[model samples]
Target: MESIKLHQFVPISGEQKPARVPRRKVNGPATAALLIKMATEILTASPTLRHQTNITLTDLAAAEKVRKALLKTPLQ
Candidate 1:
């Protein structure tokens, strides 16, 4: 008679992977103010003058006006 051998497998435990950290939003008050200025310019511009790539003088002036106003006011 021949003897039989059985093999067993076991899982190895190791150090856990480094935890993932969430990234912080870099866009702050300055970006918000710019966005507000751009939105105001677009909203105030005439429909026919609204262009995707190019900004007309009127639109630029309007946006600049809003941006200046925003800068004059204190951020809350």
Candidate 2:
């Protein structure tokens, strides 16, 4: 079995605090399916996603492609 590594702690008072468990940067097969399934609900709850970008991902292959694209890009 494997565990996830954590980073990006926040400061509390004068000391740094542990950050919440972060989400997986890349969506796997199940994750992809779940995201697509929940996307309508998520969008209904928060329509801001419409302004960010419209993405349609129906499979794991598409999810992996998106993950790869996001992780490899650099910040401006």
Candidate 3:
């Protein structure tokens, strides 16, 4: 009769896995201000402009403008 042996495997050192953190949305006034800024730029630029941005610093204003640009439609 012959005896059988089981083999054990071990993970290599320094092979630490990355930790994932859940993303939390900021709803404070700061975020509101930032979103407002982003929205403002998107609306101010010409619809047919060849350049990049839909909005620009030239369009600085209140949150009303960004919300207006978004319109009644929800983001995709």
Q: Each candidate: what lDDT?
A: 0.67, 0.56, 0.56
Candidate 2 segments exceeding 4 Å error = 1-58
Q: For residues 1-76, could you state the per-residue lDDT of candidate 3 as single tens digits?
A: 9999888887757877668898986445555556765655566654544135444444455456555554544433
Query: CA shift at 38, candidate 3, in angstroms?
Result: 0.6
lDDT (Cα, tens digit) per residue for candidate 1, span 1-76: 9999888876655866657999975645567678977676665565555565465667667777767776676656
RMSD of 3: 12.7
Q: Going through the candidates in order, what is the number of backbone clashes in each?
A: 0, 0, 3
Candidate 2 weakest ten by summed lDDT: 55-64
Residue-level lDDT of model 2, residues 1-76, one tens digit each, is 9999999885568566668898767635445445554665465455466456664334434655665565555543
- Badly placed stretches (over 4 Å) of model 3 are 1-27, 47-76
Off by over 4 Å in 1: 1-29, 34-54
Candidate 2: residue 56 lDDT (0-100): 38
Best by lDDT: 1
